[model samples]
Target chain A: MIVFVSCIILFLIGLYAIVTKRNLIKIAIGFAFIEYAVNLLFALIGFKRGALAPIITQIDKPHNFVDPIPQALVLTAIVIALGTTALMLTVILRIYNRYKTFDIAEIRKLKG
Target chain B: MLFIPLLFALPLITAFVIPILGKIYKPLVWIVTTVVSFILFIIALYGVAVTQEIPMSVYKMGNWPPPLGIVMAFDSFSAFMVLMISIIVFTTSLFSLRYLSRFTGQWKFYTLFMLMTAGMMGISITGDLFNMFVFLEIAAISSYALVAFGIEGEELEASFKYMVMGEIGGLTFLLAIALIYAKTSTLNLADISNSMQVIRGTTFFWMIIGMMLFAFSIKAGLVPFHTWAPDAYPAAPAPISSL
Candidate 1:
């Protein structure tokens, strides 16, 4: 329960960064932070108290294995996060190129 | 059985194969994408037929049962979603043929477009929670790239904003999946739904629902989460905006 609470705290911190930060890069980093926090939360969920890694070298017997589904899902999520982060960075680069500034306050062309 | 997965597989194969063919004949790209979408539409119609007769169809990969292996289940809802997607994809592919001439690397645009289509279809049909996440990400990453397709300043900024919101939603979804798995020890939707009957009134359950609601609200562009939608919709090309 404490672990899950702490994970939500990490998520809130990232949300704070996104809401408060002025720099586009910092906001992008905030997004990355959220991804990491959630991924960490997921990895922790599948942990068994004293279980071994969920790998079976021999089929004779397997017992007390940690759940592997969350691990696999987290891996896929990480790869997808990588793609989004790379694309976000590239977009930030272009924003810097045209606006000549990283501050979100100054990029006022699309204000609603 | 074969057509259940083929709805997504056909377009996925075409997405990769068309790029190679595009280098050989520039005009072949649009033709192939349009035709693939049309074929998928036909397949979706057939799926509608199958679903009408049986009500639900489940296809297990590698012949593994529902709890142990990845499953793709088609019901009326999934068939409906697929049908809608194929119709949009077919028309957009045809429309983009004329609209995309102003942009360079038209082939790349079509490639990403087809990938997004496949991803959306996969998401709608998948019965496993993790598979849905993977497909959601595939669709999302492509949309981010497509929004910034022009490489212009406004477009890039919008795409960045959209990407941040989207990533947050995706991560939250992952967290919810984790919580659910911890509780139920299963990732299959049908299994989870069946197991969910016994578990009730837990904080984790509420958290799962809350997180999923937040995540999908962002994805669906609900009122509060509408911040990124306006900017992104206008910035992307017409076909992708509609998609």
Candidate 2:
């Protein structure tokens, strides 16, 4: 339960960073943090106390094993996070190149 | 039956093929995208007709049965969405053929467009929650890149802002999926629906529903989350904005 609460806290912290931080890179880092926190929570969800890895060697043996679905999901989520992170960083680089600064306050071309 | 998978597969295959075909001939990219989208539109029409006869059709990927493997559920609603997507994609591709002549990297635009089409189609037909998320990400990522395709100052800034908010919504969705899995121990939509009956009106169920609602509202650009739509729509090209 503490771990789950910590995960929510981490997610909130990342949300705070994204909402309050002015730097483009810091915002990207916050997105990464949120991704990691979600991935961690997913992986932790399938964990079982004293359960072995989900590997079936015998047909009739009744063995305690952790749920493997969340593990597979985490792997896919990690790959997606990688793609989003790379794309975000590339966009940030382009933004910095055009604006000559990392501060979001300085880049205000699209305003209300 | 087969038309359901081809709705997405044809575009996905052509998306990768266009980049290579572009290396050989530039105009081939436009030709191929137009042809593929037209064919997809035809297939969607066929799908709608078929679903009209058979209201619900299920295609189990790799012959895996329900609750075990990913399934594509093609109902009348999915057919309607697929038809709508095909119409929009075909029209947009036709419009962009001339509209994108001024752009230097035309092939990249078509590739991303096809990917987005496939993603949206997959989302419509998929019966698994995780598969929907994957397709959603595929479409969302492609849109992010497409929004920034011009590489201009305003476009890049708008794409960045849109991406941050979108990712936050996506993460919240993943958190909800995790909780749902922990409670139901299943990711298949039908299975989850069956199991969710017992837990209906519970706090946990409401939490999951609320999280999903929040995520989808961001995707749909509801009132509170409409800020990204205004910026992103204006930043993208006319054809993409239409899509």
Q: Top DockQ: which candidate number?
A: 2
Global lDDT scores for all candidate models = 0.89, 0.91
* All DockQ scores: 0.72, 0.82
Model 2 gets an lDDT of 0.91
Instruction: Estimate, for each residue in B100-121, the C-alpha lDDT of model 2 and write its tens digit.
Output: 8888989999999999999999
Task: Point out where model 2 deviates above 4 Å.
Answer: none
Model 1 chain A worst lDDT run, 10 consecutive residues: A103-112
Task: Tell me the lDDT of model 1 at B117.
Answer: 95
Q: How well is candidate 1 docked (DockQ)?
A: 0.72
* Per-prediction TM-score: 0.96, 0.99
- Give the clashing pairs for model 2: none
Error of 1 at B106 (Å): 0.4
Worst 10 residues of 2 chain B by lDDT: B1-10
Quote the lDDT for B46 in model 2.
91
How is the predicted docking of candidate 2 categorized under the CAPRI scheme?
Answer: high
